[model samples]
Target: MTSTDHDTAPADRTAAGTAPAPAAPARRPRRELAAATVGSVVEAYDWTIYGILAPYFAEQLFPGSSPTAKLLAAYLGFALGFLVRPLGSVLIGRLTDTRGRRYGLTLTVSLIAVGSLLLAVVPGYASIGLAAPLLVVAARLVQGLSVGAENPSVAAYVTETAPGRHRYFYSAVSYGGVVLGSALSFIVLSVLLGVFGESGIENGAWRYGFLFGALLGLTALWIRRGAQESAVFTAAAPGADPAPGPDGAPGKPGGTGGTGPAGAKRAKAPSPWPVLRAHLRRLTVVFAITSGATTAFYFVTVDFPSYAEGTGAATKEESSAALLLGMVALLLAMLGGGRVADRFGALPVLRVGFAGLALGTVPLVLAMSSGRVPVQLVPAVLLFLLGLPLAVSNVFAGQLFPPAVRAVAVGLPTAVAISLFGGTFPMLAELLRSAGHNDWVPWWPAITAAAALAASWGVREHPLPGEPHA
Candidate 1:
């Protein structure tokens, strides 16, 4: 029996009247994976809320604002929040290592709750002038900080909790959360549109969406609070915390000392800087490639919707409907993409998706610009193609590093790429069109394809807790 199972063994004595009775079967890894996936989905709902509400906020909070300028500003603020994620990963990763995964997740979820609530009630530009936009910016900052460390903590938790052979399968659920969350956002917005119509959607109805986001976060917090710390974490040496360093040292205070399986502790813990110094080469490679994925995702998901709707080629309602349709297609693709990755490996799947996106980007942009029957179908087609890379990258990125530095590895790379590439993609696209280069819009996807191929080649799938690397 496992150590955990033995802990709960019956006290009945054996024939010698000295030993304890046998223990029950251990709770299987599948069950643990389920819990982790549910938690991830809940967390994603909160993170995606801002993206769904951005257009409306731009209309209300920045009336008469240029759609391009307004969307750019809002995303810039959103990107700013991503900028702080490395800090969150370091802090939360340290906490997870020192205290427990449960503690870190609880803290992150709580912060999301507070940020969502603040956004829901923040006054509009008309009511508070510059202060309104400032408040929205502040709320995003808080949310970014909370979400920054979320991926690392969740990935670490799932990897440790799952059985070896099923590690990839279980981790796929984490990416599934993104699809599920974005799909729900579209559904929710669709319903809101029906209830409020166009004017209502632009009016105060959008604020309620933020409240809804907060509610989802609170629900996630409540559900996760009941989960115990992972056995992987609890098994750390006397004081080994799993907080990730830039390198693989035990993070900050309470990091795992150089403890061996025999339970012997080293004279001193390794410093974070030494760990970082040693691993900079591999780390940079991983970061560069992974960041590209994040940029592609941001370009496709965050900016593209606004670009499509704001193009003046389509009415606001039509654009919203198309966006809603696109997300539905994306959700389905995301769910299926994970299984494909598990079967084929992340690199192949990612390479295919990225290449498809690059080639498809032009057709997709042309369709959006065409304003014809076939062109309208572009959202669904593009969503599916984009969904492929998104699903593979999300699941595999966490697998690139060992537990010691997983959080920092995942969070920082994503933050940097997203901030630089995804954040500016939409603005750049709009600028290109304004500069009389609309024909080059297809190049965006082409660039994404090249980046994806390079990054996929760079990733090294390591041995998981329960299985050998492929």
Candidate 2:
């Protein structure tokens, strides 16, 4: 048969033989989206507050001859948190896939809350000696796991629940929550600095930030408790018949089981490892993209402020204010980027963003080093560039896998990438700067951005089952 005839045969036969099932409604559930966004906010707050407050709290928690050593030790603890993220992704991701999105989100938020509370109350080096840093590391480990699972679960939920036409726009909710949470952390830091002064913050006031994060985590948990499960997940649940796609094929299954021709019984759920192995190339694409994007993210949001302060390009208060302003810019950019992605397609938008990063990072870093540009404008511009690709990154990753393996598939590799590149950024940047190789710092993210730009080419857009391809 001719190519056109071959494609049309199935449609013609299905039209002639039986009535096709109506497509699932692409309704936007406000409550569920709100819960996901709130959870994301708390997750970001809990995870980022550590890095923000580390400089103030480092001396108290770590023993070292020099302030730089203490700060490095504290950042090591931060990296330790990222180290366990993959494990969290696997364990919590499995739970998410098996139990449901809402359940996974609630559990992650609870875990992060416990970690935050632990950080708030943990004894310092002066009080507890060796156990102090150990306890801090322990807290980080817990927070890491929660954060590892949290991002992917939230991404999957938002992707599955959103209307296909506006999926990219809705995807902004994930990063928007992150930007808000990061902005809130800076706001809290500014207030604490105002009230207690730098010396007071170093003395003990930093604990309050973690305490506040714990409180916010509890609030997120309450909100998530009321969240509705993703309808796509429900339709794909084991033993539930798959919905019909536009061409009358069986829709993608979630949780477990295999899809076949319409009306065929689904095969039993296979091992996730096999499923993951089958999709290894897709996972690599997620990893490459995440490596570039998250490295840039952590560099701008977590490390750049401290780097500026250390280099005397900006003072503590100045850097803090600049970072806060940058986060606000990022928040706005995320929404705008999502809209642009929806109109132009996510891959093209991602390519453009990463290309900007790959090309512009060095110039921005040089400008910051030169202390010529306004401190606030530099970070705001840098973060705004980062926000564009980040806006729809999680959604793009979510689309790469079927529902049954979406959480773990997206979570595991993304977590690993963050752990390697994003989590290590602060410590690595500090080390380079300390070694007087500060010139090399910008190249790190620039290289990663270039890699992401290349990987974007490999990422084909996969519309949700029953949704029209973009």
The clash number for model 2 is: 0
Task: Judging by lDDT against the true structure, name the best candidate.
Answer: 2
Question: What's the TM for model 2?
Answer: 0.87
- Per-residue alpha-carbon lDDT of candidate 1 for residues 1-470, written as tens digits (9 for 90 to 100): 24432122121224565554332234355545555555566556666667767767775665445776776677566667766776776776656645556667778878877887898888777888888778877877777777777766777777566555445556666666766766676677878888997579778888777788788777777767656445554443244433333332223234334443235563242334455456565566556555555555555555555566555566555665676677778767766776766666656656676677767676667666766544357667767776776665543665655455555666665656555665456557667767876566557656756665665655465443344421
List lDDT for all candidates, in order: 0.62, 0.81
Off by over 4 Å in 2: 1-28, 240-269, 464-470
lDDT tens per residue, model 2, 239-324? 44445444333333443334444556655655689889989889999999999988888888887766777667887677878887
Candidate 1 total steric clashes: 9
> Which candidate's TM-score is highest?
2
Clashing pairs in 1: 93-243, 97-241, 97-242, 98-241, 164-466, 240-256, 241-256, 358-445, 358-446
Please provide TM-scores, in order, for all candidate models, with all chains considered together: 0.80, 0.87
